[model samples]
Target: MKKNNINDNDIILEDLQPSHAIHLYEMMQDDRIYTYIPENAPAAVETLKEKYKMFSKGSLRKEEVWLNYAIYLSSEKLYIGTLQATVQLDKRIISIAYILDPKKWGAGYAKKALSIMLQNSKEQFGHFDYYAYIDTRNERSINLVKSLGFKCVEYIENADYFKGSSSNEFVYAKISNK
Candidate 1:
């Protein structure tokens, strides 16, 4: 995968790197960040570094291309969180996901970052459908995706088993112009 570091007026999307592991671990330390996700925060920065290495090698593995970025706020000069796109090249489909520091909540940073990311993705790969799988209980995420024009296409039961229990998830999607 070609690494592209995209800069916007408010935020910069930098390719995920080993240097970001510590910041990512700190940003995701809050349990609230993982409330809706199937995976919990990494136990340590070392683990996160290993995971980042794996993600960097995603394209070589040939299963799917995982484009991961660390969200940096230019104004604050801080690493806020992360954004990822799981691209299925064979199907020409992309699934987007993101996490932001709870401290930055309600600041409209996520929306701005996503807007820039979408524009960049479209430029690099052309028009393709985007999807987001969110837990039904995550009102913020559901609303966020809805605001971006993602319609709920399915309600999946027991879609994920995390923290020792199963949880339901909703599939939200947007079909871009071909």
Candidate 2:
């Protein structure tokens, strides 16, 4: 589990726990979430809990770490989304990802959560270059990363086959000055 509790007043990101499985699973049931993602929602709450349990063990090795956080709204007392980041210390890179409930899209929650995650990652993982791989058809995600200063560096065609068709992706990177 994560030790840091990151927040920007309006939203807070805490360590993702098995307890969050139920609420998150409910949100994940929305098929729109899987449009660009290669994986479907957890088949069951138990499945998601088991996954979260493994996630709680933290990284097993020194060169890489998987960081996952659950986004919470204290005012509304609800779980709204999640943040996932892979810190590849050996490669000096960080891959950041996030998912928000479909009902909550366009509310700026993701931007705030991601901004906070990137800021915290700087302290935890140093100045590694940050990256995001988004499906070409995901315009909102593309615009979000661009607004955060990420520049598209590569276009990958037929990156993966999911939901019955092949997908092309844009590799966006926020290069570190260091």
Candidates in order, TM-scores: namely 0.94, 0.95
Per residue, candidate 1 scores C-alpha lDDT tens digits across 1-178 of 5878999887999998877998778887889998888888899999999988877666664757888899999888899988999888778788999999999988888888888888898888788899999999999888888888889999999998988889999999989877
Candidate 2: TM-score?
0.95
Angstrom error of the Cα, residue 155, model 2: value is 0.7
Clashes of each: 0, 0
Candidate 2, residues 1-178, lDDT tens digits: the string is: 3477787797999888888898788998889998999988889999998888887677888898988899998788889988999888899999989999889889888888999999999988689999999999999999999989999999999999988999999999999998
* Backbone clashes counted, model 2: 0
Error of 2 at 59 (Å): 2.9
Off by over 4 Å in 1: 61-63
Report how far off residue 59 is in candidate 1 (Å): 3.3
Residue runs of model 2 more than 4 Å from their true location after superposition = none
